[model samples]
Target chain A: MLTPLLLHVSILGLAAASALGLFATRRESPSMLGSARILAIVATLLVLALQLRRGMEFGGLPLVSRFDTLLMVAVLIVGAALSIDLTRGLSVLMIGALPVALAPLLFAAAIGMPDEHPERNLMHPAVGVHVFLTLGAYAVFGVAFVASILYLIEHRQLKARTGPSLLGMMPSLETSYRLTLRALAAGLVLLTAGIVLGYLYGRQVLSGASWRLDAKVWLTTVSWIFYVIVFGMSFVPAFKGRRTALASVACFVIVMATSWVASFWSHFHRYP
Target chain B: MELSVVGVNHRGAPVEVREQLSFEEARLPEALAELRRATGAAEAVILSTCNRVELYTVRAEGAAGAMESSHWLALQRGVPDSAIASVLYRHAGLDVIRHLFRVAGGLDAMVLGETQIIAQVKEAYRVAKDSGHADRVFNVLFQRALRVAKQIHTTTAIGAGGASVPAVAARLAGKVFQNLAQKRVMIVGAGETGEFTLAAFHERGTLDPLVVNRTVEHAERLIARFGGRAVGLDRLAGTLPEADVVITCLGSSEFCVTPDMVETAVRARRGEPIVFIDIAVPRNVHPGVNRIENIYLFDIDDLQGIVAQNISEREHELARCEPLIDSEARRALQELGEADVHEVVGRLRDAQHAMADEELRKTWPKLGALSPDQRQEIEYLLKRVTNKILHGPTTAIKEAARDGSTPVNFLEIVTKLFRIK
Candidate 1:
C-alpha cells in the first residue's frame, strides 16, 4: 500500500515530468524528449494505480461519488494518450495537453475532501454514461488542440522563411492538420450523442423533472453547433489548408469552455 | 612502390567524351577477356561505372612482368601503345591496395559518399569472378575492398539522409503527408530529372501520381510503369488542382507552370497547399507562382541549397572515415610484411629437417645402441636441436625481405655462417 508520503511523491513526479516535457520542447532535443516521455509515463501509471486502490477502499465503482468518476476518467485519458503518443513518435503532444490535465488534479488537492459522503444514487448509470462520453470527447479534443497548435507554428515558420526554431520538434504541418481534423470529427459525433443521452436519461430514467436548460447545457450545445460547422466545412475540397486547422482549433476552445461550465454547474448543483 | 591514376571524370571530361570512352555492360565481359589475353596478368579487376573506368592488377615480381602486362593492355583496348600508356594509370604494392579501398569507399564517386557505386563495384567483382578470371590475389583484393566499404557505411554518418534531389524532394513530401501512400503526386515532364523524382514518389507507398509531358507517348510510358494516369501538357492546368505535389522538370524553353496557372490552381484547390519542385536548369515553373498563398514553390536553387548542405555534412563524416581507412591500410601492410617472414621461416625449417634426416641415416648404424626404436629416438632429438638452432637465423632472413632492396649481404651471411646448401 502506498502511504500518503508516496502519493505526494507521485504528484512531485508529475511536476517533474511536466517540467521535463516543457524543457525538451524548448531545447528541441529528441534525447530530452525521450527521457521526459519515460518519466511522464511512469508517474501516470503510479497515479492511476493509487487512484484505483483508493477507489476500491471507498466502495465499488457505482457507489463512488461523481467527482471520483471525473477524476478517474481524467487519469485514464491522460495515461492512455501519453502511452499511445510514446509508441507513435508523438511525444510532443503531451507537452501541449498534459498541463491542462494536471491543473484540475492540483486544484482538487488544494480544495480538500468533500464534506458530504457519496450516496448510491439510483440514476448512477445515466450519470456514469454522460460523464464518460463528455470526458472522452475532451481527451479527443485535447489531441486535436495540440495538432492545431503545431500546424499554426509550422505555417508561420514556412511563411517567414525561417526554420521551425523550437516548434520543429512537433509533427509536420500537414500531419498535424490531418490528425486534428480526424480527432475533431470524432469528438463532434461523441458530443452530439452524449448530449442526446443526457436529455433522455433526465426525462425517462430519473424522476420526470421537466427538461430545463442550464448554463452548462446551453454552452455545451453552443460548442456542439460550432463543431458541426467546422466538420461541415471540411468537405469543401478547396478549404483543406490552414483554414481547416484554425476552424478545428476554434472548436476545441469552445469545447474547453463548455467543460468549465460543467465543472461550475456540478459544484453548484451538488453543493446547493 | 609507386601508384598513379590518369583518368578524366565528370568534372574533367565532357559528356560526349565520357560516352565515347564508356564501356557498356554487354561488352564488359569481352573487354575483360581481351584485357587478360593482352596483359598476361595472373589477376585483374575492372571497375566500370558511368563516370569512370579503371583497371586494377597485381604483377609478378620482375621488370619484365610489368612491361609485358602494360603492353598487352594497351593492345587489347585497340589504342596505340603511346596513347594507351598516356591515359592509363598504374599502382604497385601498397599504393595499389590503398587505391582500391578508397574507390570502394565512394571517395572517388561523382557525388562523394554516394552508395550506388559500391553495388556497382560489387557487381563488377561478381562478373569477373563468374568468368573464371579472378585469381587468388584479385579475389582477396576485391573482398577487402567490399569489407572496407561496409565498414565505412556502419561506422560513419556519410550515407545518412536522402543524398539525391529526388530523394530529398520525396522526404519533404513525407513531412507534408504523414502517410504518403494516401497522397496524389503529379510529374510534369518525362525528362531524366522527372523520372528520377517519379522513382522517389513511387517508393512512398501512399502516393498516387500522374505524368504529363509534351509527348503523350513518353508520358504514357511513365504512367504505365507507375500505374498513374497520363495526360498531354495541354491538360497540365486541369491536372494541377488534383495533385498534392507537383514536380516539373520539363526541357521546354518557356514557362510550363506560370503565375496565372498557380493562381487558378490554388483557388480551385480551396486553400489546400500544393508542394511544387521545379528541378530544371532553364526554369520550367515561373518564379511568380511562389507568391500565391498555400502554393509552396521550390526551384533548382532550393535543391542546390540542400545539396550543398548535404555535401558539407558528408565532408565532415569523411574526416572521421579517413583515419579508419588509414588504420586498415596500415594493418594490411603489416600483415603482408609478416607473410614475407613466414615464407622464409618455412623454407628454412624444411631445409634443416632434410639435412638432419640425411645425417641421422649415416650415423644411426654406427651408434651401437642396437635396437631400431632406440636409434629412431636419437634421430628425433637431433632433428629437434637443428630446428632450435635454425629458428633465430630464419627470423632474421624474413626481416631482411621487407626492405625491398638488395638483401645480398644478409643472404651471404646466412649461407656462410650456417654452411648449408
Candidate 2:
C-alpha cells in the first residue's frame, strides 16, 4: 500500500514540476525555475524511497519488474538533471529533462507494481550491475536527447534571426552541442561496459543456451552500433551542429525502440 | 522636506545645450557646495552624463527649490536664463521619487534599458554623500532608487540582449565559444567597422587578434592600437586555420573567405567550432561558408535583425516595469513618510510622559508624606494609564500612515494638541 502511494505521489510531484518548468521557460522567471528544481528533487527522492521499499520486499534490489526498471530510469534522469551545474541555461535544460523523467514514471504507474518476484538468477550480482549500468546509460542518453532538441531549436532560431524569444531562453548553440557530445560519450562508455558484462555473464551461465539468438541482444547491439556511428560523425566536418543533433535524436529513438522490443520479445531477458 | 529634480536630458535638449550645463567630475564637490549654498538645499546630488544632466535636491521650498537650482545652474555655466529655461524640466514631491526611480532603472536612458545610468547615478550619489552634501532624505532616496533599479533588472527582462551591432556580434561569438579569451581572433579588413568589431571581441578578453588586411601598414596600425600581429591579405589562407573567430569588413566585390578556405580550416581545427561575423557592404565572407559544418556565419543583416528584436523585447518589458515601478515608488514614498510619522509618534509619547511627571509633582504637595511602596504603586498605575491612553492614537496614526489614509495635517493636529515642540 505504501509503495503504491509513494509511486503516485512521485508521479504527481514530477508532473507538477514539469508543468512549472514549462511555465518558467515561457516566463523566464528564475524563482519559478528554482521552485521547479526543488519539487523535482522531492519527487526524485520519493521515487528512490519507493524503490528502496520494493527492494526490501523482494529481499534484494528490485531489478526484475518492469515497474522497477522504469522507476530506476526516472530516478537516474532526475538525478542527472539535478546534479548538473545550475547555470541560467540549466533551467532551460531542466524544462526538457523534467518531462522526460516524468514519462517513465507515468509508464510505470500504468504497469503497476509487480506481485511476484523474478527467477533467482535474475538477482545475481552480475545481472544487477549490468541492469544498473544499462539504465544509467539510458538516462544519460535521455539527457543528450533533450540537449539535442534544444540545440536544434536554438540553431534554427539563430539561423532564422528570430531574436531572443522564448526559444532564446535555451542555452547557446555551442553549449547545447558540447552537452550533447559529452553526454553521448558518457552514455556510450556505460553502454559498452554493460554490454561487455552481459556478454561475459551469458557466456559463463547460459553456455548451453542459444543466448546469441535473443532479440534483446540483437536490438541492444544495433542501438550501440548506431550510437557509435553518431558519436563518430560528430568529428566529421559535414555533420557538426544540425546534423549531429538530428542523429543524436534519432539514436535515442532507436534506443527507446530497442528497450520496448526487448521487453516484449526477448527469450531470456524479458522483464517479469 | 520635499524632494525635487531639475535637469536637461537627451529628450529635452541637444548636446550643445547639455554640454554647456554639464559639470565635470573633478569640479563636482565645488559645484555641489556652491549649488547648496546658492539654493539653500539641505541635500543635493548632481548626475552628469553624456545623455543627461540632472540635479537632485532636498529642500523645504519644493518646486521653487528646483527652479532656484536650475537658475543657479544656468548662471554658473554662463548660459542665458532664457536659453536654459525652455529646456529645463522639474519634478517635485512624489514625482521626484518616480523620476529618479525611472532614471536609475534605465527607463530614461537614450537606449531603453541601458545599464550605465545606474552606475552613473550611484557615482553621483557617492560624490554627494562623501562631500557631505547628501543627508538623511537623499541617502534613503538614492539607496532605495539603486535597489529598485537592481530589482527591476533582475526580475524583468529589461536588459535582455545587446543593442548594438558589435555587441550582437560578440554575443553571437559567445554563444559559439564557451571561453572567448582562449579563442584566436582574425580581422579580415582595416575598415572602421572591422576595428569596432575587433574592439568588441577585445573587450571580451580576446586581446591579441591576427589582422589580415590589404595593407600591412594599415593592419599594423590596428594591431598597434589593439594588441595583435599584422599580416597582409596574402597570409589569409595560411593564417585562416589558426583563428577561432573571423570578423570580415573588407569592401570587396567577391568573398574574401570562400567555402574551400573554410573547409580546409575546419579540417585543420579538428571539428572545433568557428564563428564568422561579416559586417561589410557586399559581404566579405562567402555565404556558402555557413553551410560548412563547424562554421557559424552571421552577416550584418542578421546582427541588425537581432538588435531590432532585442529593442522590441525591451520595449515590451517596459510595459511590465511601469506597474512595478509605480507600486514600488508609492511604497517607498509611504515608507519614507512613515519615518516622519514615527518621529511624531515618539514626540507624542514623550510629551505624555512629561505631562504625567508634571501632574505627579503637582499632586505630591497636596498629599501627606507616603511610604515608598505606596508611591511606587501610584507611579506604576500612572505609567500604565499613560500607555493605555497613547495606544489608541498610536495604532490609528500608524495605520493611517501605512495606508495613506492619514488626514492632511493629522500629525500637525497631534503635535499642537500635545504641545510637542
Candidate 1 displacement at residue B398 in angstroms: 13
- Superposed by TM-score, candidate 2 places the C-alpha of residue B69 at a distance from the truth, in angstroms, of 1.2
Off by over 4 Å in 2: A85-89, A207-209, B60-67, B351-400, B405-420
Worst 10 residues of 1 chain A by lDDT: A159-168
Task: Kindly report which residue pairs in candidate 1 clash with one another.
Answer: A238-B269, A238-B270, B180-B206, B181-B205, B181-B206, B181-B207, B182-B206
RMSD of each: 7.4, 3.1
Q: Candidate 1 — what's its lDDT?
A: 0.68
- Interface C-alpha root-mean-square deviation, candidates in order: 4.4, 2.7
Best by TM-score: 2
Question: Predicted candidate 2: what Cα RMSD to the true structure?
Answer: 3.1
lDDT of the structure predicted as candidate 2: 0.87
N/CA/C clash count, model 2: 0
True contacts kept of 1: 0.37
lDDT of 2 by residue, B182-265 (tens): 888999998898899899899889858999989888787797889889888988988999999999999799988999988998
